[model samples]
Target: MKDVIVIGAGPSGSYAAYRLSKMGLDVLLLEEHKEVGKPVECTGLVSKRVLDFVKTRSIAGKVYGANIYFPNGKSIHVEKNDETIVLYRDSFDKDVAAMAIGAGADIRINARAISVKENNDSVTVKYRDSGQLKEDNAKVVIGADGINSVVRRDLYRIRQEKVVSTLQYDMAGKIEDERSVNVYLGSKYTHGFFGWAVPGGEIIRVGTGSYRASAYPYMKALSKRFGTNRVLGITGAGIPIKIAKSLFTKRSVLIGDAGGIVKPLSGGGIYTGIFSANLASERVANAIENEDYSQLRHYDKDIRGSIGVELKKDGFIQSIYSKIGDRSFDRIYGLISSEKIIDTINRSGDIDYPSKVIFKVLIRNPALLYSMWK
Candidate 1:
């Protein structure tokens, strides 16, 4: 029996297992995927502030600005002071796995968790290992699995309130522009969400996102709009979003995507996942040592308090964004300074959603502000 069983060996899982193992707890990390960070769903564009939060050096692409396009063919170029890193997600995820291994956590690759059972003080995790199934016991279970987390389904009824399915691809062609990313804020191109152009290696990570049911159609539209005919094959998938508070249960904690730590605005969960895993590991270990596990609710509260306001504000912004007509978008796009746009994408995943800041900007421009309010 281990002290903790961490399901999913991605960013969140690795961080949780690492923290627990460092504290001398027997931590077992399970990963369903054969390896970490393949079929990369992330664009890997994160703010400078993210570097301060995440403790690894796995940067691949660096960006300084972005280009925003309205539905009316009007566009604005924006710049930022902070540098955002666009990493090769595969390398980054593998390195994160290394961190867990360094901390002495027992990692089982290709181990898919089947089910989990919790009885008062202990949790039993049944998983398939090396073509054979096995069951293990642990005092605590942390679900760090990605979007379609089995742990969440098995443990609790996760309310699907704020989830958006995102589709993206790592293309092979050389991007014409690599320094500044591209974003389209029109529902025609991407329904109820937006589309993006992220630079990775020699390919452009182009994709779109929306609510789950609409994701496939929206992604197809984006494919047609982005010159998919000229492009090679595309990669796509549903990105789990945590637009609201997460579900936490007894003797179990859901971290990262499993817990819905994704950015409400950008649908970026990598940074939030790692950060939550770190906190969960530390807090869970502390609880075990002190024999006071009642305050497990703190995990959810702490994450929400640190990131909730921003996420809520961004959610509101995205709501206003996807509804805007072409003409309204043009006026608002004009009101939105290039400086603001650049700064937004660069640091969007790190700090609070700039709602208060947007309010101030709107006050300066009445017509644009009024549109947002509506």
Candidate 2:
């Protein structure tokens, strides 16, 4: 039996395995795909804080700011000294998994976990490997899987309440400003979410998310508005806008998208997921070494104490953002487009903790609150 079993070799899983194995624990990392990060679905835009978690070489491009467009044709520009790293997501996943393997964690590719059963002393995972049935036993199981996680569903009987279906195309064409991303905000473009155009080196990634209907039509419309529809590649993903209520059980815990540990505003999970994984590794190690399985509950408490505060705020903001119509968005944009508010945003805006700017803006211009109410 292994000391720890990490399902799904994404950044969170790989990082957890890497940390535990480095501590001399017998860890097993499993990947369903033959390759580590194949069928990439992410826009790959992440903050520099990701570097603090893992040193990587999957950088594709960098942008220093964002241009947010409202439905009324007005926009707000926010810039910062720090740049957002556009990653080659496939290479990024491979890099993290390599770190785990280097740290003595055994990894199995083409391994799909079908079911997980938690016993009093250990957890058993049944999976299909190369079309053959296999099983592994571990003192603790960490479900670092994606949004549609078998471990989360089978073990916890949990499901995401609301998820945004997104679609994007990598278009080969000219980009207006490669230094900044373009954000289109409105229910007209996307019902529950918004549209985005992120510049890569040679291609611009154009995508949209929808809550009421298909995101394809909205994405196509967004690509048309951007004036570049020549496609290079296409990708789609589902983002859980709400965090899961239950993340830990007797002998198992879910991390990353599986636990809905993503940002509600931006739907970015890398930083938060890996951050939780780091915390989880400590708790898991302590539980195993101390032989107190109940200690695993602290992982949930630890997460709620840290990023959970930020996620809670972001979720409240998203609830309003999703329900607001184009008129409200236009009004909000007009109210916040001032030089003073822009400066406040530029100073406080963080991709990882986005709600900071909103609070700061409200504090500076209390009129914005009345404007929101109206």
Candidate 3:
């Protein structure tokens, strides 16, 4: 029996497995896909903190600022002293997996975990490999299997209040400025959400996410404006904006998207996933050393304490933005276009946690509070 079986070989699972193995625990990491990081769903845009955490280098390009467009063609530009990196997600995932393997964690590809059962002493994970069903016993189970997680389904009911449907296309073209990203905000493009154009080294990734299913038309229009139609690939996925009611039950725990740790505002999960994975690994090690599985509760408490408040604040912000019309968005753009506000954003804006600046900005300009409240 393994000390812990981590389902899903994404950054969260691999990193957790690596950490647990480094602590002299037997760890098994499983990935359903034939290879790790296939059919990339994320836009691959992440902060520098991710690269620093994994202790690896990123060959991807950097984005210095964002051009946020409103429905009336008015825009707000926010530049930052520190830039965000456009990650080559496939390479990033493989690097973390390699570290896990180097730390003595065994990884099995093409292994799809279907069911999980927790007993008094250990948890049994049932998975399918090579068309054959198999089971593995472990003292603890970590579910980093993503938004539609099988482990989470077996353990508890995940009530996702909203799931953003995302569609992205990799088009062959060169953006005018590779150092900045473009964000389209309007009801016409994405109802209750937004669209983005990220510059990859040679190609631009154009995508949109909305609560409504009809988003392709807007994406296609945006693509045409770029003047290139040579499509390389297209991918679709769901982003869960709601946090799960519970993250652990007895011997099993869920991290990453499976636990809905994604940022409610930007729909980014890389940094949060890595952060949660690190905490979960520590809890796993403690539970195993003391031979007491109940110690897993600390994992829940720690994660919630760290990022829970941020998620809740972002959720409220999302709700406010979702209800506003395009004209209201223009008004917001006008308010944020002030030199003082823009300067404040440039100095304090954090993509991973925009709420920090939002509160600060609101406090500085009390008049702007009417725009959000009214």
lDDT of each: 0.74, 0.89, 0.86
For candidate 3, write residues 131-209 as lDDT tens digits: 6899999999999999889888887766656788888888888777788999998876786889899999888888888
Q: Which one is best on lDDT?
A: 2
**Candidate RMSDs in order:** 2.9, 1.2, 1.4
Cα lDDT tens digits, model 1, 262-310, are 7766787777787788778777887788777776778778777776666
Worst 10 residues of 2 by lDDT: 220-229
lDDT of 2 by residue, 312-338 (tens): 999998887777778777888888999
Worst 10 residues of 1 by lDDT: 344-353
Tell me the spans in candidate 1 whose CA falls farther than 4 Å from its real position.
53-57, 224-233, 243-246, 337-352
Q: Where in model 3 is the C-alpha error above 4 Å? A: none
When 2 and 3 are scored with TM-score, the better candidate is 2
Each candidate's clash count: 1, 0, 0
TM per candidate:
0.90, 0.97, 0.96
